[model samples]
Target: MIRTSAAALAFLVAALPATAGERMNLGIGTIFDNDAMGDGDDRWRSGSFAISHFRGPEWRGKLPEAPGSFIEWRFRSEIITPENVSGTAITSDRRYVGVLSAGLHTHFQRNGAEVSLGADIVAIGPQTGLDDFQDAVHDLIGTSEPRSAVNQIGNDIVPTVTLEVGRELALAGNGHVRFRPFVEAQAGIETLVRIGGDFTFGGTGMGAFRMRDVVTGQRIDGVIGTADTGLSFLVGGDIAYVADSFYLPSRLGFDLTETRNRLRAGLQYDGEIASVFYGVTWLGEEFEAQPESQVVGTIAINLNF
Candidate 1:
């Protein structure tokens, strides 16, 4: 997975249900670039699948002060190709890497704001099948050269924690037109201090605003942003500053340092039984000597019960 800033992490944590909420949500999203449209690099791709289980009355009874809470678990996967992306040889740095990760989180909401915390663990290397899968996919399409998987991280395990603070804003509203804006800031072992916001329109569900807090994963609250089961549409943009990341490539036998900015734009629609979200993001160069930054497109779908 890409290393991002604190603002991204904060936004993600704020979007989830706070440990004792009323509903559950299941969703999947892909973070990629316009390579699918033949307009951008195809080297970096990532996806996330997640589900939120309601905290329920039994759990709320034990913690009455925070009745709307839930446990969220997510599956994360990613593939990186520095050489292919930059179109240059990379020495010492990893050439490619495939990663699979999972995390368990709990969140709470109160007075139009939310607090969240969670932990995730990562596994990297060939066993992850990210590189081979990409190779097979590209072979089917007949690309120039197949990409090699990176082994620098070497089957290591990385554990990180998540924390965030978020606020929901109701700027204006009417039967047909409504506006809501929000802001959040948070820190993760992966992202030091990320901050971002969103402005939403159309309906009054979580689906009415930007649904993703992170480029690759959906936040617990954003997942329920439209939990009321209504027809809604949303459009929004976000920006963030990331301090450092263990996920990005490093050199000199040390983890690389980063403090770049990230920007994203997205649109979404929430319906009665299912919803869809499409978004795109630009990441600042991960390494100083790198040629250019990265652009990725993401799509998310959910089944509501």
Candidate 2:
């Protein structure tokens, strides 16, 4: 589904005067999260993997307003299971759900604010093959089998649209500290409005375009940075009011928790040849019957050779 025709490729190459095929790759980022990395529990929000790519003609260390200055493609896979995957009987827990999403987003600047707009096709249920994937992984590790896959969420494909607007504030003159405040809106698989802000204490991603993860809300690099190498720390949080969710349908006797909250902190270490990022996030309850909140960890590594 993600194929580029020869004519289209030629058109894009010809459009960029100096960068025909020289500076195509902007950056790539991947995040893997599991409960084993945080809180020591693997109940709700079991695990997820996401990757994103930012590509364009060339990045000039600034967000351009041109229509196609930069393009972002993201893919994600996730699995949600009951509290006990091996249990034979259905407990009063969240139902099993598998999700795979792919989307394309465009980034630009408007009125001194960074603007991101995109749409995704979200597929949910056993069709995503996440149940089988998890089964294989657990079997290899001698973990309990997710028997509840037989009753996982029904199959459905939903189209979701997301939009975010944010502006960075330079708190220190030397670009050592910066703050970004943003507002976001989404409609589709989950309908909600969110407001949040992020703070940076170093120069890890000074001039790079970053993409926010859906589950953890961590900023992963999309466009590689060309700034100084060092260590940087980040802290951010957000609150949202959700109106609907396809994962936990009301028709299935699940009660939705309208207000959702998340808190996260991360650090980045940039070296001459590679960079590493690790972050932990506290995910608030999503349903009324949900137990206490849970913490999840995210990690990413990028190497330049």
Candidate 3:
């Protein structure tokens, strides 16, 4: 898998236009998510953090029409654990897993549609040090120790490619209400096909660049801009059909749910010198033996003081 992914990345890099690397500095965006902010139950899909830096020739207030006109370098880390941290027994829950990924992506427009293409080299298992990190956090917070840490998923590297295409439709001439429907496909790590749509009820992010969150699929800003100073609302949902997953090792008899669903809503405030985004997402069952659904919260703040 590692060799294949490397070759795939090489092919992709070779296919880029000559000017892909020549661009000016743009902006940066960051996001953090945790189950603690939701139901306070830190279990599967526990937490994640992501930061992306974008560069281009200039800020055109919208995606450029040419391919590779804008580039984004993204870094992300994630930790997933079983339901009970201290339990040593073999439950039907998912094994502890840690992931760190870095990738390069391009955002562009073609024929009135928005497109993103990227590839990530995803590292999984204890090598990410997430198990130890989680232990330290738990110890500091006086939470239960991760007794089952020794039984986590083995280490592996997977090369994943992701592609998404969508078009934004302005439901209101003033840009108060807009809807964007998209289709996304992935190859590697967890292979799946997804279809979804997002709605914006205000002018917070109009004509701005936004990046989608991996876990919750929430679109967060990718570049700080002269946003309209006001409050905006977001609502979105998606359904995915999974073909395979590395997290659910077939040899271990872990059952993978064929269908997955997610629903999310958020509010954003762009003040004079600061901006804040807060959202909650409801995640449907991922495994057949899983107990129930879970809710997670996400937040992103930028202060330009």
TM-score for each candidate, following the candidate numbering: 0.70, 0.89, 0.94
lDDT of 2 at 117: 77
What TM-score number comes out for model 1? 0.70
Per residue, candidate 1 scores C-alpha lDDT tens digits across 38-96 of 22666543333333332323322112225224445556666666545424545634456
Candidate 1 lDDT score at position 19: 46
- Alpha-carbon error at 115 in model 3, in Å? 0.4
Off by over 4 Å in 1: 1-39, 44-68, 83-88, 92-94, 150-152, 174-191, 204-213, 216-243, 249-258
The better-scoring model by TM-score among 1 and 3 is 3
**Model 3 worst lDDT run, 10 consecutive residues:** 8-17
219, model 1: CA deviation in Å? 7.0
In model 3, the Cα lDDT at residue 273 comes to 51
Off by over 4 Å in 3: 20-22, 225-227, 271-274, 302-305
lDDT of 2 by residue, 119-143 (tens): 7778899889998998999899999
| lDDT values for all models | 0.50, 0.79, 0.84
Q: Flag the better candidate by TM-score, 1 or 2.
A: 2
